[model samples]
Target: MKFWRWLVILALYAVPVAVFFTVGVVVVWRSGRCWWLWWLAPLCWIAAYLLTRTWRKQLAPPAETGFVSPGHWTPRDGEAWHVVESHRRHVEDIAPGQLTDPHFYLQSAMDLALAVARHYHPKAKDPIGSLTVLDLLAAAQLAIEDSAQWCRQYVPASHLLTVDQWRTLGKTPAWLSAASNVTWAATVLMNPLNFGRYLIARFTTQAATQQLREHALGWFYLYFVSQVGFYLIEMNSGRLRGGAARYRRLQADLQRTADPPVGNEATSAAVTPEPPAEPLAVRIALVGQVKAGKSSLVNALLGRQQAAVDVLPQTKQVQQYELRVNATEDRLVLLDTAGYSDAGATPEQMREMQEAVRGADLVLLVMDAASPARRADVKLLGELSAWLEANLHRKPAPVLGVLTHLDQLRPTLEWTPPYAWREPSRPKEHNIAAAVAYTRQQFGTQLAEVVPVCTDVARGRAWGAYEELLPAMLGVLGEARACALLRTLHAELDAHRVQVLFQQLGRASTGLLRAGLAKLLDAPT
Candidate 1:
């Protein structure tokens, strides 16, 4: 029935055109375009048919249920809000082999770090961990700038290429290169103009000019598309993937090296700091957004003003504060990470944060209860959880939400605190409960615990509800210590990988002059 219907429609549209052309109507037409007018009638009919089918296929939902798009549109949790985050936190969707690749991107990013390391002039020639705060900041900015337009990966080709002292390995197969070159050339010449370049040039001036003008649009269109196709297929097929796989070897080796030595005194100081003789020390990272009272919480945790409290962002690098307890002086080293935001951090800032997180046994993700934008904080929790699971193969690192600035909740004038939190009695308690519930709901199972606090000091409301926070942090640290070997290994391996890559880059850079001289001598002058 459908086929017959389509046949009838075609006959209704095409029959008249066939009749008119057959009867010499086109030759007798006054306007030159009049000959082509029959073509428009069938096209319009087909378009109208498609339009009618489309409208009938999509039936409207009930008016009583309100308006919505087709396919029973349903709202996704956090999807709407995710779009409003800071530009920094959002991942730029970069397509491979389109003016860039991961290798070049990594290289371009590390250039800033290299320059910063040199500027700082560290005594050690290994990894630049001893870099000053200012140096790190500058490197971070440069990394951000470079990332805006990536040039290459941070790993050197020599580092990526596996070698046995006798000779370097993994050279490209001659056949592969030959095939790619021939295929690309053939594809380029597949365009008639590209193949007929000489033939067209041989024509008389006027005739050649007219022919070239007529084919110019088709010529350029095919040329541009072919280049894009080449990047996608030929250039992408072998080298990029091979280099990336080789590079991962460096990462794996590093992860293994990052492992802290077990029962070894000399390197034990890294995880177990030497001061006041603490048998078991735990590192806790305080992570959150700017003005989320991270600094104030740090000071409160140490029972001192360790961090400067400000309206604007203040905490820059990972600052440490020691929390001592018990006769043996077991310590909780609170690593105050820069307040994070959805807007994202500079590359340097992210690196420092990762370093802190990598070593930390526990994370205190702080969020402002008064003005809650918990997306960034929640994301960090899920990421840490996933990372811990992947690395330690145990439960994810425990994350506790430290919802600060309770004083600014709703009635900004209200400073009073002591209320029935267990059984809400006032608006303040209601708001506090709501914020905690909302945060927990967003985080779901990712968050281990949530505690609300007010870290204001100027008005003597420096009341951070840290009583539960301390216990929770201590509990997580103790649990994390069970997998101390894994954490240590991860750290050591990462450090070693960085050192190796940097060393390879040094070798490559140093050999530049020799390489240039050799090339110059061999040049066909």
Candidate 2:
């Protein structure tokens, strides 16, 4: 019955193909001089191949879902980054048949694990052997969870799909394939010009399918590497010391740290894990020239007088204040640095301010809206940006320009509660608007946003702190959280390295003592 069905399909397909072949022969025989037109078919095929190659190079495969962002997951360490990138290139250039092997993904995952393990644990003969069974299981568990989450989110009704159903979906029906070929041949035979079109279409379809398959498989390989590599990094760094549960909890916390709450409270609460006992602290550095309202802004954020505000450069040193921004309980540490000189910061002061900025997750560049002098502010900000750019390991903290003393801008006495600086109508609003624009122009991309605020809450002049500044802070909290996580990871890596060094020393000393004792006892006996 199957043979008969295939025979019928071949008969249907052969009719149109035979017609096309006959027409080509007759045309070529009659028009001997124009027979060179036959070259067009091969040329079209060549063009199709070129186009497919171009697409293959241009198109990147879709990355797996549920993994942390590439920027975050990708190693900042030079040696580690090189290893992952090399693996990626290897995958891209992989043999076509390798995609179909059941163990291809496993092998790729193992290779990545071993490669990264060797880099981290170079002394070990079998780097992977150093990992505890629990560590390996934990890493595998996280990878599986990530893949499962991706399937759940992207593949609709995935749970309903059985093994047979999945296999059926992957396969093309033989009857349908035969019918399609016949239909395509008929389409080409109906018009001789369609011969070229037919060649191009066939080549394109075949090339595209091959390229798509390769890219899709390549994407999965890279995704597996990224997932496994990320957890491996944590394991090797000693951050996963508490076991799989602890690692998973840490991962969930990092996710929450990086991805801020979206949609309504119920949805956010449902998706978000319970607040950690010690929420990751996102440090915000308030930096500007003397009397730029740095302390006042800090006071406003904290809703109390924590940092002493004075006319004669009150904050002589970098002071940190614990702050809880609106809505989320993610701890924010506000760093109020010593205000710099109006002309330009001293080299010593610059070093101090830059150090504070370096440690910070975010920067609040306080500027006096009433005063136009920003040389010191701009110089310091430029230095900080330059420093951040030079440091390849650290993520650049997002900067928010806090334009203070908005009440003292123009129409000085006309302090309105809700001044629409965005689209100004009133004189005070217009002045505030101009200041914000000027600040933005001066800073360019340095500041994410410049918000005008009056932070003198003692004088009943607190505006835009909650409505503008806090919201702006929240807007960049996601990015700030990412920066914070990178810092935490680095700290853990350092601590882990130190711990490993001491452990090796302890082992060496213990071995030496045991050897000496054995020699002494044997000789006396």
Candidate with the greatest TM-score versus the true structure: 2
Q: State the lDDT of candidate 2 residue by residue for 1-525, as single tens digits.
A: 124432343343344456548667667647869655545444544554565565554455533233334334423344465666667666646787887787987787777777777776777566467776656667667668877999999998798999898888777566677887886687567657657766665666466556756766777677666666666666654445545676665566666655565321233566656677777888989888888898898888788888778664544477888986445777889888888779898777787888898889899999999998988787887777677656645778889999999878778787767999898889988889999999899989988999989998878999988888887887787788777877776677566768877998999999999999999989954
lDDT of 1 by residue, 1-525 (tens): 134443454464456567667756536345565545434443544443453344321221111212122111112211211221211121122222321244644443343334323323335353245444433344344345444444235534533444562143333445565675575466347543333332322232224223323333333333323222222221111112223333233234323323323321133444543332224456778887777788888777667776767555544567888876431133568888876666655566666777887777677888888775666665665665566545422324567888888887877787776645558988888888888898889888777888887767656886644454555554454344433433543455456667877998999987997899999999999
What lDDT does model 1 reach?
A: 0.52
Off by over 4 Å in 2: 1-95, 98-250, 261-268, 314-316, 507-525
Query: Which ranges of candidate 1 are over 4 A from the true structure?
Result: 1-278, 311-316, 326-329, 389-395, 475-477, 483-525
CA-lDDT, candidates in order: 0.52, 0.72
Instruction: State the local distance difference test value for candidate 2.
Output: 0.72
Give the CA lDDT, 0 to 100, for residue 56 in model 1: 29
Which whole-number lDDT from 0 to 100 does residue 276 have in model 2? 70
Which pairs clash in the backbone of model 2?
A: none
TM-score of 1: 0.40
